[model samples]
Target: MLLADGIHAVITDRHGGISAEPYTSRNLGGAVGDDFDAVLRNRHDTAVELGVDPARVVMMRQVHGRDVRFVTEPFGDDPPPLDAIYTTEPGLALNVLVADCAPVLLADPVARVVGAAHSGRPGTQLGVVPALVEAMATRGAEPYQMVALIGPAACGLCYEVPAEMREDVARVVPEAWATTRQGTPAVDIRAAIEAQLHKANITDIRHDARCTIETPDLFSYRRDSRTGRFGGFIWLDGG
Candidate 1:
């Protein structure tokens, strides 16, 4: 899965690598209890596949809140506690690991600035997408010219939530409020995110309609809590 021009944006699935069961195959999440070595290997392989430098690839410890970071260089060892990361510098790959939460890739090719965000239910309610656009604005990127790409996540029909929770989220992201196949309350994170993008004046938006929970090819925390996480990456071509 790839998108945008000039900027390299790739969505990684659970298909290759050496993480054992539960966190089977291409699991890039190191903290999910997957073999640390395997996670490192997967991350390295993912970077190589994208033509990005493994040493410069940065992954955030997503807290599911609206925190954005401007990366000029890689974080030596510790991953930052953030949900979104933007960078104008090339060679550094911004990665967001997700099992069900929507992974968003944003880029302003003209400005050569790109961003990656993890927008979960809580993050969506907190308006993480808007926060990301604002962060990009600081780097001379505008919403109108940005291209937004949303990756696989849990769909409304499969993301049944408590009525009260749905109401709370709806208050913030009304576009997400939906009904499940069983007549239960649910939230379409993807729809809510797309609505947010439109609200930000971003017209060039693409979505990977494959639902992680429903699609066996992707990792799904809802379907398998102990499962591994797939990764979404965005990088500028320094060359």
Candidate 2:
């Protein structure tokens, strides 16, 4: 998807690649129990399909914190534990892997800045998406001029949580408070993220409404404990 004049974003699903059963095919996450080589292959293939160099794709360790980094190159074999990364360099695609967590892509074409963030329950509470916006602002990207794409994740109706847990998250993010379809407590991570983006003054927001837990084509840790992770990739068109 073209996010702006020269910025592009892509969200991957479970179909297409070679990771085997549990982590079957197109699993871009290396930390998962999938074969190392298979995960590497999947990453390479996904980058190629996106017209980006595999060597240039920057993947995060994603500790589900609010740590944001301004990266000029890939993190190599040992990526730091971070939830968000922004870059001013063109063609260096920032990758965020997730099963049920929200993968957020942000870009300001005029500033030539792009960022990707991993926002799960903890990350949302920590305000990772807002942190990413701040990191990108350091490179001249303004919140009002930026566009955001939120990828597939567990929806409120399917993301049931303990009553105490929901109340705790809602204390920090009221928009996260929700009730599941079965009338149980739930936390709407995506809705909370959207609210966060709006609070940051990013009005141009798009979303892939597919719920990971309800969508079979996408990996969902809540639905299947042992599952592969898909990726949300964002990059500039030229180097």
Candidate 3:
């Protein structure tokens, strides 16, 4: 279990489970064209490893947008199209899949709530982090009391975007240009996420110092073109 000071979570790597190559071992997403059985087994293994009930661990068909799903109760049904999820309920594990896109986990120790955000360019533009924070606040969470951790993702040095894309990012965040490298602009997704967290008054933020595109151990969608998804899961434990 990858335990934070106040929450239970794990940022799963591409090893240790059963999936064929490309997705070669530990692919948790069944909808990513991985075999259903393999995906199920992989998820079960991850849940057990993280100490969450396999039944309470929930994953949605992520649409890469800003839709935030508010979880007030536990259920086995497919969640609505959303890129962010939050819950104050114990034993409810929220899972988000990512390869190069950043997976962000937020927890409020005082409020006893946890949230997960999927921050691709689209999800960032749509303000998924703020949306998750807002949802948590509705469940009696205070933004300033939260601690956020951004898991492994593609770093700014490796992400080269077209000029037009850079301008698009500037519309929301003007400093996005500073994260660029050379003429080809690249956004520091982790930095951008931290900025958003700051804007929401979330002070205690952490980031894994790993870049998927540059690291062989990590699965990168952009690097391989076809790759398996990695998981970032968080849940509140019932004491």
Candidate 4:
């Protein structure tokens, strides 16, 4: 899906890479017990498909909080610790790793900028999207001109949260209760993120119906205890 004008990006599944066993085929995380070479290869292929230089795609260690970083240029070496990333520069891709957590791609076509965020329970509880929005605005993005794509994530139907976790979600937005669709209480992370988007005045929104946990093609941390991660990346077009 498209987030901003002149921007192209996609979220990948776990079925097309070279990793083996628990990582299976397309694991993109180097720190999750997968062979580093396998994760590197998957990352390289993913970048090629998106027309980005593997080196320009910036990623973070992902501390699962509300931290967001606005990158004016690609990282020189190791990435910083952050949950969300935004960049206005063309050819610089922003990547966020996830298994069951939500990956959000944000864009302001008019500004020619894009952002990607890792939103699991912890990041959601910490308000990562809102932080991303504010960070993008500082780089000159306006909410009305932004389009947000909530990609494949753990669906509420398959994501049964503990009662305490549900209560934490409720504390953020009481309306989150409406997303509960089954016997076991689930959190519609997309809905919760969308609510945050609306609050920020970002109206363009799209939600992919794929559930990473229920679907075998993608990776899921909760579904498979030793699973690898799939990545979501975006960048402004060059040439």
TM-scores for the candidates: 0.97, 0.99, 0.93, 0.94
Clash-forming residue pairs, model 2: none
lDDT of 2 by residue, 89-167 (tens): 8899999999999999999988999999999999999999999999899899999999999999999999999999999
lDDT of 3 at 105: 93
Give the clashing residue pairs of candidate 3, or none: none
lDDT of 4 by residue, 1-239 (tens): 45556888788888888999989998989889999988889989888877788878888888889988888776655777889999888889888899888999999988887999999877877899999999999888999999888888887777788777888887996545434466877677767888999999999888776988888988898899898998888888883
List candidate 4 stretches off by more than 4 Å: 178-182
Identify the runs in model 1 with alpha carbons over 4 angstroms from their true place: none
Estimate the TM-score for candidate 4: 0.94
> What would you estimate as the lDDT of candidate 1?
0.90
**3 versus 4: better TM-score goes to:** 4
Please provide the root mean square deviation of candidate 4 (C-alpha atoms, Å).
1.7
Worst 10 residues of 1 by lDDT: 1-10
Descending-TM-score candidate ranking? 2, 1, 4, 3
> Model 1, range 37-80, lDDT digits (tens) per residue?
88889889878887888889888888989999998887777877
- Give a tens-digit lDDT track for model 3, residues 86-180: 88888888999999999999998888989998998778877888888998898888987888889998888878888788778867865455343
Pick out the ten consecutive residues of candidate 2 with the lowest summed lDDT: 23-32
Top candidate, metric lDDT: 2
Candidate 3 backbone overlaps, count:
0
Off by over 4 Å in 2: none
